[model samples]
Target: MSDIEDKKNSLIEKMGSEIITLAHGSGGKAMQKLIDQVILGFFGQPNQGPLEDQAIFDLSAYPNHSIALTTDSYVVTPLQFPGSSIGHLAVNGTVNDISVSGAIPLYLTCGLILEEGLLFKELIEVIADMAEAAEQAKVKIVTGDTKVVDRGSCDKLFINTAGVGVVNNSLNIRIPNIEVGDKVIINGDIGDHGVAILAARGELDLQTTITSDCQPLNGLIQTLLAEGIPIKAMRDVTRGGLATVLNEYAQGVNLGVLIQEAQIPMKTEVRGVCEVLGLDPLYLANEGKLAAVVPAEYADKAVEIMSKHPAGQNSCIVAEIVEDHAGRVVMQSDFGGKRVVDMLVGEQLPRIC
Candidate 1:
């Protein structure tokens, strides 16, 4: 959008082929031009500086704040999925990790691995989405590197990202802060991401109208923190899903977790898919979901505030920390029977970011 970005965009036009080749990875004009035009063009030069081996940030603005850092790699198959792509997932995933630590996501670093003969147009599209996701999360992509591998050496694409954030020096959200009678609240329905990925793979020959709830939650979480919700501990319901998260929390403080099945929200289609496949929705992955444990006194306020946000319209208290059955997670099913919800032994869905 600036004169510098305008100049950078021209480099993409200088590449030799519409598709990537080994030459693009060579230390030559084509590679430099490609990186500059793609990264700088969409992300804009961060901190008004040139790209270098490392990114620099001025700490003066964040004085009295503690720094939080996180990193993750994305290898989601089918690079482009129904509600989001690997690019968007990479950005949101890293941002969520930093945010769950009660930090304000500020900057990110992107590392890309591309297979030979990958489509040039596809690369631009992914980079654009990553930039858009970063902007939505109010963060910047500061630095990145790209490598091209031989065909069949790697998937079509793989992305690695690192995030940096600033947290209030006084705020420390951790499992140690959780206590008995604390209500467990979730932002919205679960299992959409896992089911969506399963459908995308077409390995099961399934059909559905489900879409991944892939969006940034920094704004939603920050709003509660700003309003003094007093969240005890919070975690993004990612890879291992809500069951795993609660298990971790319960074991962390050696307490019991009781979640009512009726209160755990899920879309009808997602539930139906899980039922037909004999899969438990409790362990289904989510990209844009989070579980926050707040005291009973603030539970109403927490749900009230969360439901107002677009990312948390179905927010509600699904469970609570208890003293009975310490060191384990229990669930009250719709049939009025109690059962133990154990940790996932093996991954239910793979490459599901």
Candidate 2:
């Protein structure tokens, strides 16, 4: 076995606990083990073994057509924010999730829980926003369900969306495609959605005019694919942020990832809030960003295509897969020091989505 494999095995052996804890949910070592031993170990499939942000199944030999399906729920508090509202977030989140899986999101089903005494005008506004976002994303709300609950039983609104899209081809983007030398690319600034919500809720002291980066990314992914760029896998870094997503990739591929903190895209205002709040931007949440693992040879082409698109204009190569530090994400700080960038165990800003 390689040196790194030996080391990782030894580390796992030494973790002497069988009981569950909140740290396991933190997206750190504890969570990693829980998923590896409990979830992935039992249910993982050959092609769908925890790689990619989503699973890709083969249908080439079966049916002539293939489909991609995904679901997501948005429970961001305050219902509305500076740049977008929970309505837009719910729709975009589901659309982007399916899009990054290399599918063309075609239809969505929305389920909403409305609290009693909700302002009728506000409900209409939210639906209007959802319609506008659906139009922009080129998807339709073909079906939906609505329910009303006591004022104290439910928040202002909670939205759950399920989406389906046709896979243009049988090629699946699984995480196992990530090799030792693949490049990591992020679409744009991180933590805008989380910080924006926090600011709107008066959770932060300082703020600038910044909006949530909530938007559909299917168009951007379509553009990238048309360019014939080789993307090993794709994921929208929403909850649990980029760090958690990278850690998920690392475990799936059994490879280590080293990212340069300097290369991560974060807006100045978001950075300020993270600093004041003592939160690592890596652990912060983002709504409209995506992480792509590309073959090293095609990294440049991928970045170029991404930069030309509106949602990915600031795309940059943040890191590369490595053989060492297996199942871990390490970051090279600006000060020339290295630190383990693990996932947050609990929600950093809960109800912010």
- The prediction achieving the highest TM-score against the true structure is 1
Give per-candidate clash totals.
0, 5
lDDT of 2 by residue, 177-222 (tens): 8899999999888888888888789754656688899989999988
TM-scores for candidates 1 onward, in order: 0.94, 0.81
- Residues 79-167, candidate 1, lDDT per residue (tens digit)? 88789989899999999999987899999999999999887767876887798788788898988888989999888889999999999
C-alpha displacement of 176 in model 2, angstroms? 1.2
Candidate lDDT scores, in order, read: 0.88, 0.78
Minimum summed lDDT over a 10-residue window in model 1 is located at 3-12
Error of 2 at 271 (Å): 1.3
